[model samples]
Target chain A: MSTVLLEEEMTDTPAAPARLLSAGPAAPGQEAAWEQFTKIPLPTRTDERWRFANVKDLDLSPYLQPQPVDETTREELLARSRGLEKAAGRMVFANDQLLSREVLSESLTRLGVVWLPLEQALVEYPDLLQQYFMREEAILGGQKFAALHASQVRTGMLLFVPRGIEIDLPVEAFHWLHGANSSCFPHTLIIAEERAKVTVVDYYESADTNAPGLACAVNDLWLGAGAQVTYVCAQNWSREALAFQINATVVGRDAQARSLFAQLGGRHVRSESVSHLRGPGGRSDMLALTVADNAQEVDARTFQIHEAPNTSSDLLYKNSLDDAARTIFSGLIRVDPGAQMTDAYQKVRNLLLSDDAEANSAPGLEIEADNVRCTHGATSGQIEQEELFYLMSRGISKRAAQKLIVNGFLQEVIERLDQPEIGARLAEMVQAKFAAHR
Target chain B: MSSLKIQDLHVRIGEKEIIRGLTLEIPKGEVHAIMGPNGSGKSTLSKAIGGHPDYTITSGDVLLDGVSILGMEPDERARQGLFLAFQYPMEIPGVSNANFLRAALNSRQSEGEEIEAVDFYEHLYEEMDKLEMRREFTSRAVNEGFSGGEKKRNEILQMAMLKPKYAILDETDSGLDIDALKIVSAGVNAQRGPNIGCLVITHYQRLLDYIVPDVVHVMVDGRIVRNGPKELALELEEKGYDFIKDALAEPVSA
Candidate 1:
């Protein structure tokens, strides 16, 4: 748990051109941020926020900045980048580089909806980009990785829905890690003005099987008064890669935000999600589903901060672990002073599929306000013997029965999404993951 | 030509013996009923034949077309043309009834063979119509939050869909009212043909009137003491089970 300097980690990473520091055209003071990124110390076992994490796996010395993918590989990824049948727009990224962009319906552009890649958004809407980009500090033990993402991120998407504008179809972004021993940082920013409604989906994948890669991702979401937003993150990296994801959500007066994170891949994954209720009558729903197997580890840390009165937040996280896999869920709800009538609930459920698999759950609540309702709980269980027997009696094999029950267990989270297209897509991805691993 | 035969079966649950020295035969094209008093091992006999893990066959052979099914797993036995209509059907959450039935049907087909979606739906609707099940049941989770009568009807719906060579209906008439019993019985009767055999296990003679069993067997103390033509069911209803008890207590003179 000794302190390790970032300079030591960077000694193995070769220097890149100055243009690489700035993610896009008008991201102001990128050089200063890169300088600050190098001074932040790497997370160690001694950090309380990373208690159950496999700290040794966080070593970044062996990884280097990813090179641009070849044209053939780019074409292949673009061909395979399929999602919902109907999307408002789609952007695909490989190794922190934009591969392809598809815009839907010229009518949407005429409606004043700004859907562009980060580089383009930086150049065209510099003021908006500078206002909301990474404004929230990292507070969930990913400070070092957050800084790394800010320093190296070059490709992502920016979605802005103007006031009173509602889009029927979801916008999607796909990020793929392409080669062995390569690393990429993908960032996404979404802003919904007053009374605007939208849904955004982000998918993470690896281009090849068994490729060792590093994926550091950051997402910033802002919801104005009465705005409703749904964000879904489908993270399905290869089994040999390391992944770090940091998500921060800000909900304004009377605004409602719902975010669902589906984690299905990566050898070692650490996800930190923070939801801030910044105004009265704001509600945020945080949900996550993780399927970890084959010695993989998934560590999730979440925070729900109720900073205003009459705010409510509900968080549900479910994990299914098999083989020698491990999962850690640590979540806390804090109701600050003057945040009266605040309601918060945090629950973590784990399903262990093997005797050797391990699941650690820690749920806590901090209430400094009166007339507040806060509850938190964690539960770990295996497939019910009777449920398995019932399925097997219906002629399903043991393996298939376990798969069905696991899917059924995780289906609740997807059903909570209440978005059919995205739910169906997430279900397909989860089923595909199960099929491949089994 | 197909028959389900139980030969000198002795079954146990954990360390306690349940079905002792029992034997029966049910052949295709015939509906046989087994009526027994409470604690007579009628349900145990059905579970033992269906390969329930809780019941162990210390000495017995359950043969489907003359092959012993004791060595097979429950699903293997099910896929090998054996079905057990449970008295209390399981409620599987989040698994649609259509999907559950499809999985069962798919298990019978060879690998890489896909079930036609349209044909499957058509067939399912037809069976549901016979049972008077609402079309919404297909999309609902299997037996989840279903009423008592609805759960029993779902069991019958499954029996109709699977079309196993041999089916053991263990108390399928337990929780149904008179109306539901008639509907369920009609559903069972419709599936009766030269290709399928049925063994109806019940505690009361009430179910026998609806299904019209060709043979009635009175089981006592884990064994069938008397079996006769369909008229025996009517006689048992009139004379009560005391007739068999008195007869068994008296020695059989050579």
Candidate 2:
């Protein structure tokens, strides 16, 4: 029949990865999500959101849905998913399958803290997951990729804390890609009630350094009045992999939120981050660091929205490019009419190590509020001659001196996080990437 | 043989020649001083000896322990045990003093060898305390937001940590207050021993009061015009550099 011929042709040209949901039947919401995704047209050069992006990396026909991981490989990845020594809870996922989850302390559970995998949370707390999961449409490009992620996302964590609850230790998750041309979607949704505080860390990596893979990740953080949240994502996927990461944060009255992203790997990575200051006395600190080498391309977009009065947002992104690598950063700080006394600052710095490396930065500001202070700028430079000579005159070699200078260049952003342990861990990962460059 | 020997060294900055055929030596176990007025090419000599990129040694031979270091890079010469204590130490933002010093010491080690973190901190604290530097300085960015006196003391701290065989302190007393001068001079005096040869370049006799040199060389124009005992620094400070220009019977030009 004609349908058989169509099916054969569909097989001949691979479709997007099949979703492996554990539930008996597909959720009705995902079908709609998929339908919405299929209807959205792919990005083109003329599109403003996809400006300066490499559209060739968007071809998804070659990628297959992540297959089931073998027991041996799963165990190997579990052993390799090393992170902070002590965490409140930790989860390890390989090939989009949850391998292990360390439960929170009994006292935490008794305090009304809820931490569950996405699949389990969907069955137990459907209303809560439905309310927060992928709720904000992708506003800064990657809309199609985000919908694809929403439909296929099967693993990640959902953490909820009640009012006045504070978790001193951090919660962490590790997502590892295992196979070639395989695709995985990771989603993290955290909701904190009034006066609650929490910190979370995510590590995205690959099992092999040379395997080509695809990772589309989305994380959302919602803070109620007076709540605080600190999030750090250390993305060190394989050098041959393609990655897309989208992040959104909403801060309520008298609340504070800080998030940092370190881009250390992947051949071509697209990252979008948005911060919403929705109430008075709300503050958001968004920071990013990228060490792009070889032929890697890292395109990053950020948005800071001041939706309420007396709110503030600060953004700093630093990039160190070497060996023909390129990086793009486009950021905007928007102040709504009612958001008076809003203070917003955005800065992007690019440190080029090689002549062939390229850096493109576009910093924009839109202010509709009166009595507001907003400043935005971008700078690109190489190491200072005097700084280099000063270090080298003390017997530091050219390479080591360059390393010191680059570390200093990137340290300003890391220190702004104010998390010494997490910052140190991130610095180590950055050094590891630098060590690999011949 | 074990000395920092400069024989007929000529240095040029851009198209103009700064040092015109200067020769001097500071043997091990001695603290020799170079006293000159401003624009007498004293700083240029130090920079040339340290292989600063801007100062090219047109025709010179600077020997470290009888081996010529003309072909080595600045860092290589530094590893060869030649140290230059800059008068105006650079302020490197975001790089802590501790990390900078550690990187310097690590560069001196053989490949695949690194200093243990604990041991490094222990030794660093010891030296910093000797210099009367507060413990908080270890974590501060190198010389960033530091006072003039503090910058001079930091140079001394580096000198104490490196303990090089040959050292050229170019105008170390230029920016220091009286109290700072005493502390920094004492720190330098602590490293005065048989293994090091020092060249203390100064424009005033104030620093020499604390750090007494064994001998003094007076430079006029681009060459050393006279050599005397440590009292020459006092004499030069008393009579002023015009006496040297009068004695040279020529116009002093850099």
Candidate 3:
């Protein structure tokens, strides 16, 4: 497998044959959207949404859409795509191409569920795709990239849980960027109808940590009236790669939606997450954890919008920075005028491991509603000396003690997920990342 | 083989000397109690010997089993079989007591050696039973939100689990009630043997009633001025530290 991957690296030819945008049996309205993508200018630092970002890295000339891999590389990737022991369904994609799909149980299909690749779903359920695809605007920025994703994204998962159905196990999707200078745009759109319940996990990882690549990803979640949905996105890109992920969630009347974003490995990552409580008695929980080391920079932005009466939303983001790493967290909670009796909270905590590392937090709130309760806070601090002393007094070396404390800091966010297996796995992965740096 | 010897140890925080040339020796097969007044540097001596960074060892040496541990780090000193039961144990928010103890034990092993999970749990349960600690305490974060007595008991529990050669209990009886003091002392007494040496630093002799020491020393102005058998503690308890200070005022012959 290594020999085949090495052979592919030696070849200078483009991995995938660039299909001339010939009007070959185009999907009805997609062509116009594709045309719109070509017209939209790439984002620049001048744009308010792209402020404080390294816009020069937005150049897309060197990254080509990668082609499908040979059998050996494909088998190797499939072998490594394993995740949790019991997943409802699993799909593996390599270099923007589907490699394997496994529907573990027939019960899921019989329950009126639609879990398939985006292209297949588009062909079979175009109306459903049209009703939900890109429905929630990229309000937190990444509009141009969202447009590009809409134009070029061809492989991902589209999950639809019908009304009154609940899938107990989580659905898993894996996206791998294989070659150097490769770019993959992965999209996940999930809609849970009234009284429906489901959980979905998306894993973004690179084949090699030092390989340069670009990952432009987007996920949209819609919870119907009285539905409950939990989504988790674990991003572990290579050290030399650049990643951008935009997530938008809409919660309906009497519904609950919780989303966790775990940023484990990325050279330079910018994630924008937004939750909209659009119906009465709706609730949304937004949680994120990031461990940044070396020269990595993780920029995260979040928004909690209460648009209806008696709604609640909470957002928590925790980051641990070491060496010369950097992290920025900007979050806002906005309650509309009609969102009376609303409850909203936002908190950002940063644990700095090195004196030279930097963390910037900006928390804001704008409420036009009456009888509402809201609070927002941001804190950046080093590990308490007493806490370190406590650990060292127990025979743990200073380095190991620091690592444990940092892990404990991030574990608080992971623990809030209420899923033991997932929380333990994430903690282990974060600890492994810390150990590798040592 | 296990002993702690402090010779003319002068410790300071910045320019102010706290422990002014103190000297004491505790050997294995014995438990020694250091009784002092409130501001007499009993806690400072314990911390200084454990290599606390804030307390500077100005001009003396602390030897553990004939090896000077003045230059070692706190953790290295711990690995060398020295333990300091803190007066106020720190609250580590998210690290469970079980994992914390496991890490300490893991550090004693060579590189790449792993602790067997089943055996670790068995050992932990046995130690918890000895300390009368609940199994649930294993899941709780170390000293977080624990009551005063609970924290002291937790300190003793850790001392028992680590099985150190020389254990320094600094004010372990400070906030504990009488009942809790007995329980905590029982845990300490259970570990007393020829292989372990204990230095119990306290302000009152009340704790000595439970964990009866083999030797008792009166400390004043950061120095041990008198040393005797267990009866010395009872004498100090009745006469108080002032009487001991008056006696130490007399000049000593060479």
Candidate 4:
């Protein structure tokens, strides 16, 4: 591992040149786009959304393309990635290299379904990949990181479901970052055509807690007319790592989409998620849960856009902060002029476990449609004293009681996913993170 | 040697004295009843003895097995063999009863030692059966949406599992109908043994009828005015609390 770290350290010096050459495989039309990405500036302290955030901590200088590990380490990570024993298919990647892939049933694959790695998908389905790749720009101030991700990403999964087909079980993807200052770009693109239904889970984790790495990831979901899609992402990067993820979902007429983001790790992390209810009767649900402890900081921003009549969207984000950790949630819901009957709701709840911990929430709604129903709220509070007393009276220690209450508070958002297996696994992971902090 | 001793305990809440120099000793192998009207500080004494932070113990001490526990935290006090069955149990949303009870038991274990899951479940199921609780109740959130009777029974179920040396039942009979009272009392009676002491607090003497006490103490104005055998509860029930209050007034006036 030290040898690999040494090699990664040496490669970090020429990162910019390596990134430029990495973009050589892009199609002709993407050449100008890649150049445009190079011209974009990185986020700085002057940026409003980046204020209060430690911009100096956003150092990408020491990270390099992670080197592959031995078969023994790969096997160990593969065994650890075994979550949700009943998953439809499981794919494990170590150091941005695919270690194993469990193929789905033939019947499901025959229904015009495509479940393959991003590299393989790029070679086999170039046209399909081109249509959705980086189509929706990072409007939430992560453009530089998003561009850097597009230029360097090599390990990810693509799920393409043809018209009118529904996959009952969810597909799973795991991306593990190993070695010091290792960088990984995990990309997931899911396209469900007319009347199709599908679910996908993208899990991010690190090989060890001491490794300082970077994860710049993107997930794009395109739901066609009358389609339904559910996407869940659990980000459990190492505590010494930095992570940035941008997610965008486009919903067509009568289509429904639900997405959940679980952030249980990362020393400094920022996530931006946007949902575009583009056509009539489209609906989207955006849910997030974050557990920030120690000196970690988690910044999350979200947007819901009702572009057509009868569109609806609901967003809920919950955070539990301990020690000197901090969390910021900024969300907005917008209803267009012609989007009559638009229904949107946004809520952010923060549970503070320490006097020094901080939680900042900003919730906003703009409704141009006269008949729209929109509500947004943000609340920050410590665990109720009476509730703590109730648990303590039952013989639970103060520390254990606080953990239980926080878990219960966050379970509301997890339960909203309506997938029992995934909810349980996510809860376990969150509990594990809490235990580590203790 | 199992016993709970309260020595002239004076507790206050916001500068107002609730338990004024009240003392009581309950030894193992016996059941004691403290009957009083509302605002008589019966609940305050129980909470103070259990080491609740909100209830300030201005004077005196609480002891378990002759060991002082007044300086310990509530959970530490509990681990020292003291338990307080709350009058109004709180509703904890999204935390299953099984998990809550497991945490409580886990807290009692030595550091870095874990409870055996199979044995824990077996003990839990046995206690639930004695309390007449359904198996499905284990999965429900702790006391969330539980009826008054269910909450009291759940408290008894916890007492059974914890097997405390001394347990204080504060208003355990309040809001319970004849059927629920019988069920709850039966659960309590089943736990009564030579190893455990019980202090049952109630306004009415009806609860004593089922889990008949060995001694009956009449508490009024934050002090125990009279102490006697089991028949005393029957006498008090026949003649209401006013008889005791009027009787005590005459002596004070003289």
The candidate with the higher TM-score, 2 or 4, is 2
Cα lDDT for residue A74, candidate 2: 69
TM-score, chain A, candidate 1: 0.93
* Model 1 lDDT per residue over B1-254, tens place: 36888988999999999888888889888889998788989989987887778888999788898888899998998888888888888887777889888888887789978689999999999999999999999988888999989999999899888888888899988889999999999999999999988999988889988898988888888888888888988888889888888888521210
Each model's C-alpha lDDT?
Answer: 0.87, 0.88, 0.86, 0.86
Clashing residue pairs for model 4: none
Error of 1 at B251 (Å): 12
Ranking by lDDT: 2, 1, 4, 3
Candidate 4 A-chain TM? 0.92
lDDT of 3 at A392: 82
Clashing pairs in 3: none
lDDT of 1 by residue, A206-242 (tens): 9986898889999989999999999999998889999
Which of the two, 1 or 2, has more DockQ? 2
Q: Considering TM-score, which of the candidate structures 1 and 4 is the better prediction for this target?
A: 1
A26-100: candidate 4 lDDT, tens digit per residue: 434445546656777767999976766778888777776666666667778988886677777878877667777
Look at candidate 2 and tell me the lDDT of residue A185: 85
Which ranges in model 4 have alpha carbons more than 4 Å from their true place? A1-33, A66-73, B234-239, B249-254
Winner by DockQ: 2
lDDT of 3 by residue, A1-438 (tens): 123443454354544544323322124455655686567787777886666666776666666665666667778888988678888888888877777789897797898999988878988899998899988888777776676677678678899999999999889999998878777888899999999999898888888878988888999999999999999998988988888898999999999999999998878898999999999999999999999999888889888999999999988899999899888888889999999999998989999999988998878888898789999999999999878877887789999898878877887888888877777777877877887896
lDDT of 4 by residue, B43-130 (tens): 9898788777788988987779999998888888888778888899888888899999999888889998878999999999998988
Model 3: which docking level applies? medium
User: For every model in order, what is the iRMS?
Assistant: 1.3, 0.7, 0.9, 1.1
The positional error of residue A56 in candidate 2, measured at the CA in angstroms, is 2.7
Model 1 quality (TM-score):
0.93
